[model samples]
Target chain A: MTIEDLIEEFDDLGDWADQCEVLIDMGRDLSNMSDNLKTEDTKVHGCQSNVWMVAEVKSEPLRIELTADSDAMLVRGLLSVVLMVYSNRSPQEILETDVRDIFSRLGLDRHLSPARKNGLSGMVTRVRAIAAEAVGLQS
Target chain B: MTTDMSQRPPFDVEAVRGDFPILNRPLESGRHRKGKPPAFLDSGASAQKPQCVIDREREVEEQFFANAYRGVYYFGARVDEELEATRSGIAKFIGAESTDEIIFTSGTTMSLNLVARAWGGKFLEPGDEVLITEMEHHANIVPWQMACAERGATLRWLPLTEDRRLDMSRLDEFLTPKTKMLAVTSMSNVLGTINAISELARRAHDVGSLICVDAAQSVPHRMTDASGQHNEVEPVDFLAFSGHKLYGPTGVGVLYGRRDLLCEMNPFLGGGHMISQVYRDHSTWADPPAKFEAGTLPIVQAIALGAAVEYVSGLGLDRIHAHESQLLGYAHEQLATISGLTIYGPDLEHKGAICSFTIDGAAAEDLANLLDIRGVFVRHGHHCAMPLHEVLGVQASVRASFGVYNSCSDIDRLVDGLQFALERLIVAEK
Candidate 1:
């Protein structure tokens, strides 16, 4: 689903509890990332949780597909939300996306802010780097 | 949540709780949870300030504000007198011989850094070793590591046993002739393992090694005798603890050193107040504390900390310990009932009032966040002790630590929060 759809779903939720429930459900719904893919190269540093993320560049469309996992259920749920915004999009598109605004609207800012230096922000940093690298290679 | 309070003296917890205004005020998250009072179990991180301490700080700042020891003005004299009185009170609190041994620093981290840099730099030689524990807070470990590396000294570890207590059996092997210093925590910030400081001090003295204690966790909870007058232990050469952890303001801590040791050591930070005679060629240093306290100290905070010492002294650490020990037993019993929860330290007998644990599928941060929703504050992650976390065989764990103000109701809320978190996150794991 698109980031807009996710935002709408979150907005429809009544309170923090509903939003948390939906987030956890989304985390549960995330496709299982292979254990083998969770290597040192895929690890995201500066996170309190153990998070792993890998980005693949689609040659035809120059789009980045992101896959990630976390030992934390909430982080996995956050990964779902982050992935929804960044994955399956062109490198340029991902670069232009305002992920912070989206997170603020969802009221997940307090739960996962950049100040935390946690999984969500670390994933975003990794994603942006991969996208920028892809752009650098293309040029 | 009914604790065994039969053996202890009458502890008026409600009266104690009334002194801390923050405890009565509902947390910001309480809006969602029907204005629930905060079950602040993160005192192991930093205790909440009492109104008296807060008032003391305001009284200092508003009434007689001046740089300590700088002027002969009335305000300056009042400030210096107050600072000296605070220092004397602290020395008395820890049973230090003289007020000069107590050097005020920013916090426990600063206190540890000061001792490691100043004392270790002056004494440690090549081929010497500094023995520390694997379960120490990073504040205790990293400073020593840096000091050792800089001074060409070897750093060694005293590993923890399976139950998370220090393996004292290996003490002889670790404490050799070359062991110049034995730096250890009085209590583990994460595991709550209360190390035998007196025993360790005796053993270190036997090997002719000076012992420095990171008492950030211990000093607030129990009695500490640096001079070892009443306590069975030998005099601790160096001891450090933070004021904030003792329910005072932040940015103020005490570093108690042996008089001779403080006099012999060079200053960690060289600046204005530390110098006695200043020439362009070279400068001589001041007496013990002034030699160490090189800048404008956290004047108001230190005075407030004096008030904190007074408050804790009035309540008596004995009663606090009794109340907390019983509460800790209750917490252990309650937390154990939850399926898949594994507490990481020894039984109540071997530890303090802190509880660190992990559930089967719920991650530490997730559990902590969920607890916050219920107005229960806890600490998550490695708690600045990564090596201990590695030893515990987990990436991270949730910690619910208690203070004098905490009650059985806090534990109930913590249990309630954990159950809710388990129901929500564990199911999500599937």
Candidate 2:
């Protein structure tokens, strides 16, 4: 689903549980990244759960796609939200996207605990860094 | 909620709850502070201040309103009197021999930093070793590391046993003479393990190395015996704990060191109030305490901490410990009912009022968030002990810590919230 479509879906799901179900469902749909690709170079720290995210840059239209996994169901659910925003997007678009605004719009900022908010912030940092790396954009 | 545990002896929890005005406070959300009974379970981090402590602070600040130890005026005199009274009170609270032994700092972190920088930096040399455990909070670990790097000293580690207690089996090897010092927590904040500091202190003493106990987790819950104790075990040379952790205000902490050690050490921070006399390029420090308290003291916070001492002392540590242990047992009993929940501490009588746990299929942060929405606030994450968590084989965990104000009903609410969070967070794959 497009990021906007997923945001709409989250809005439709009035309850926190329903929104979380969508996150886990998205995680179930996300392709498993190989362990070889989950090296120290790709592992993102500061997550409350073990999360490994990797970015692929392609030159056809200068696109960057990200795939990630987490040890905890809730984190995977949260990652799905992150992936919906940045995955398979152009490097320019990914770099330009305001994930904080997205998190606020989703009400995750108010709903999530401080620790989760920080971990999600870290995930956003890692993703933006990857996109910025691909197109040499300033973060 | 279990009525049996709540009605325990020596602790009147309802009365204790009355002391803290902030308990069951309104919840703040989305620009509006709404209503919710504060199920504050994060005393593992910082505690709710007692109403008496708050009143005392306001009174001191509003009435005294003067810099201490300098002004010959009545206001300054009152500030000095109250601050020193708090100093002595803290000394008595921790079983210190004298008030000179108590060095006030910003918090546990700053107290430890003083121990590392002022003491370790002065004494440690090349090839000297400092030993600490995996259970140490970053406050205890990082300062010594900084000292080791600066003075060419090396650092060693003590591992955690399977039951989450410190592994003391290899004490002889770890406490070698080259090991000039050992820093250890008196209790594990995350695991809730009550360490035998006296036994550890005696061992370190036998090996000719002093030990510094981080009693930040212990002092708030139990009686600290820095004086004579059971088993004929001598007190450690130094102990540090925070005011905030003990139901006092923040920005005040106590570092109790042996009198001689304080006299011998260089000051951590160099400024006014700590010096005896100052030259253009050199300065000599005053005696213990003032020698260490270089800047304007956190007068009101420290005085309120004295009131906190009074409050805790009035309840009695044994009673508080008993009440908490009973509540902890009830929580352990209840949380154990959930099949996939993993509690991380050993079941022991002396354990602190803390439970750090994780569910098989849920994130610690999410679980804490779920509880938070229900107005049951808890701490989640590595709890500043990433290595201890690494040893436990988890990235983070949810911690529910208790204070004198907490009741069995709080634990009940917590379990219900956890079950609710689990309903959605756990997939069938679990």
Candidate 3:
């Protein structure tokens, strides 16, 4: 979705300040990993919160799904922001997009804890690795 | 008609408070209602600068700004002298054996990285372990992990006890002969637990390992001397702390290594001022302090940091310690009475000036935001010690830390803001 669409979706939910909460809540709803799925294999490294991401590369384009279990709800929200930007994109698109630049545009860097920033970096790295594997398969 | 000033204790809290210019300015939001005041409680991250330190920095820049160690001009000579004097002052303040052992760097992170790269990276071998505690900030943990990774060494961690103190009882388990280095923080930034560095250093030495103490948290509020005096604790092999935390300017910090160890290690960064003799094929390096300091150092900031050390030292660290402990005790007692608040670290008696607590049913960021609206500034996060937070079973906590200038009134304002925030959260839930 475009930035405008995302902004509109956020604004429609509540006040501008509450939009973050709404986004976080959306993240919470999207993140519903079962206990059985919360294995070491699915765990995302370097996150202060326990995040598990499982993405499948469909035939036409990449489709990814992620679930995070964190005592802190905001971290779950942050993970959701990551998913919205990365999931459902092709490997080429995923690698080309500037994730750090997007985070800068959204002012996510200032609002996030250093650990969360590192977590975001870890998430980006994992997604890039997955994308690279997919591209290698096609080549 | 004069007030009975003599009746008060010899240490003047209000006088000490006046030195910090940030306290007088309007809060960052620049607005206040009647009978409301802004209280700052984020000293655990970095402290507000005193006017003396600020003025010293400006004076250096405006008058004597020049590159150090290689200039023969008037400004260069003066700047070099000021830089060396600051080195001596820092070395004296931390109780180091000599100024030669002290190296200035960007901050604590760089200082720790220098050690990890130079000493830890060079000496440590495959199958050797570097021991650190769960309470380490990222600056302490990441460097060792990186060094170990590069050197094919193992990294081991000592767990934090339930009370958040370092589990020293199991120290022997981690201090194997294969352990080349033990790095730990003197105080926990998130939980405020004070680790016994001397004890840990003794244990490491017993097993033929050296200890590096991250004194970033302790140096600010307590007396920390690298030179072991009659009553002072024994010095660790290497100690690192930031200038900003101790009322000095940012972008300057100190790394105090034992002279012998510093001579043994290779240089971390290579550039001008660090080399002794150079050719197209080979080069020789300078002695300890100059060898580690690669380029033209942060000369102005270093001089200002010396002024800061003098300013704080004049007031006496013992007095500062007592003052902070008093405020911390009162803050702990008051915060404990608040319902649904769970504090990390040992009770006020066993900790330093930091207090990290979580309000039941409210996110730490949300609580911090609410408090911010009320002009009560606090830090809300994992505090760069995420592993410690994980061990404590908390994702984030609201930290209210005290410095030399903090008073009981500041604590009162924090309590008032917290109570209001809790009320609002509870009402919204209903």
Candidate 4:
């Protein structure tokens, strides 16, 4: 499915259980991170989970990939949910997508802790920075 | 929500609990089972407001709400009176010398940002150090980092010991001459560790550094005098806390600064109600509190906050603390019996009512979700301090906190929910 199609499908879940199941499926579907890309440069600073995200700009569209490891299974599941909307989009598209609005539509923000919210923001920041770099702006 | 007086002495628990309508109501999401009532275990994120505070807010909005300090009509005067009364009430509650020392902002985050921008932004230079512990909420941490980055200052962290308390043994080493400010939390929202503020203040003072306390977690649960005048403890230079956490309306908070220091610092935001005289060339600013209170204040919310302070004070903080302590002790004992559940914070004697714990082999989010299915609400994740979570060697933890309306039975519900969730998870794995 196209990223947009997948997001729509994920958003169709009626309750949190279905949402979580879809999130796990998304995690299983995520493209693996290359070993060379696993470095401090790709690390998200403020997340409790060890989330590593890397972005690269090719000719037509930018590509974003994320891999998160946590002792906690649901955090890994949450990272999968974050990646579904965020990965494999142009930098500008990533910035303009209104991730928070998407989260609000799913009623996910209420269930999240303040730290997870910050982590979500941090992920957005990381993606935006990569996007800014692709467009030749200092982040 | 009514407490039985026959079981114990008739404290004002009933009257106090009655004020908070949310305590009696079911959760917004309903109960776990079809017939069972919802049990709320999360008061740490934000608290449910009392009906009195809410009604007061609505009353002000309907009758007396107006732009404070700048209005010329009768409504404006009434609003100004109500707004000023909030400052006075806050000042008195915190034992400040005068209302001029109190500044209203959107909430604790903005209040702390004011200190970081106005005080740290102006005074701190490159190479100056800002000392903060690992346990601060992001609201306290990010603002200082922003200020430090702007001024080319360096940020220093005070480490936490094995027990999750601040490692005070090396406190002197951290408070060096380069330190211009020390910002710390009075009570950690995640770990529930109440630091020795007086000792911290004294240490900061000895190094000629100003100390700012984030009392967002402490002010609601205990008797806190941030004003620095009435107590023998060396006064904190600035204090910030939110109204919503203290059973008041949201969108309003207090920032207490020493009068002279407030007078010396520039205002953080500017639009209206902050200037004495305006002109094209130059406009003179008003005095301290007015200078900081720019734009239209949250007048009705402020009035409700005043009422909230009155409500909490009437319950008597000493009695409230005693009641919560009893619940905390009971919770600690029960939680200790659960295998693979590791609690982080000071010992029960030193901690407040907040408890953070991680269960083995189960994600905090999943555990929280399971607890929700059992009609128990809890906060799961890093609790806004990612650095502290990293220090604690856990990805995230489930936090169950208490408020004035909470009782021992509430803790029992939480424990039951947690045990049930753990068993269900184990069964599902099997």
Identify the leading candidate in terms of lDDT. Answer: 1
Supply candidate 1's per-residue lDDT for B299.
Answer: 98
Q: Is the docking of candidate 2 incorrect, acceptable, medium or high quality?
A: acceptable
Residue B298's C-alpha lDDT in candidate 4?
A: 79
lDDT of 1: 0.89
Best by DockQ: 1
The number of the candidate with the highest TM-score is 1
> What is candidate 3's lDDT per residue for B1-430, written digit by digit as tens?
1124345467787888888877876654322333344588998888888889999999998998888988899999999899889999888788888999899999999999999999976798999999999999999999999999999999999987778788878888888999999999988898888887778877888899999999999998776766565346666899999999898889999999999999999899999989899999988999989999998788888999999899888777777877888988899899988988998998666689999999888778767765775778899878998888889887888999988788999999899988876665554446
TM-score of chain A of 2: 0.84
- CA lDDT, candidate 4, residue B171: 96
Off by over 4 Å in 4: A1-139, B1-15, B28-31, B35-37
Error (Å) of candidate 2 at residue B144 is 1.9
* Global fold similarity of model 2 (TM-score): 0.90
Candidate 1 per-residue C-alpha lDDT over A1-139 given as tens digits, one digit per residue, 9 for 90 to 100: 7777777887787467667777777888888799999898888887777788889999888899989888877778888887888888999988898676788877778565463545566668778888899999999
**What does TM-score give for chain A of every model?**
0.89, 0.84, 0.79, 0.71
Calculate the i-RMS of every candidate, to one decimal place: 2.3, 4.8, 6.0, 4.3
lDDT of 2 by residue, B32-123 (tens): 22376778899989999988899999998788779889898999988899889999988887888888999889999998999999999799
Judge the docking of candidate 3 as incorrect, acceptable, medium or high: incorrect
lDDT of 4 by residue, B49-127 (tens): 8888888988888987777776789999988888778788889888788889898888899999999999987899999
lDDT of 4 at B99: 88
- lDDT per residue (tens digit) for residues B1-430 in model 1: 1235565459888889999999998666512555767889999999999999999999998999999999999999999999999999999989898899999999999999999999898888989999999999999999999999999999999998888899999899999888999999999999999999999999999999999999999999988999898765688899999999999999999999999999998789999899999999999999989999998999999999999999998878888998999999999999989999999899889999899999987889889878877788898999999888887888899999999999999999999999888889886455
Least accurate stretch of 10 residues (summed lDDT) in model 2 chain B?
Answer: B1-10
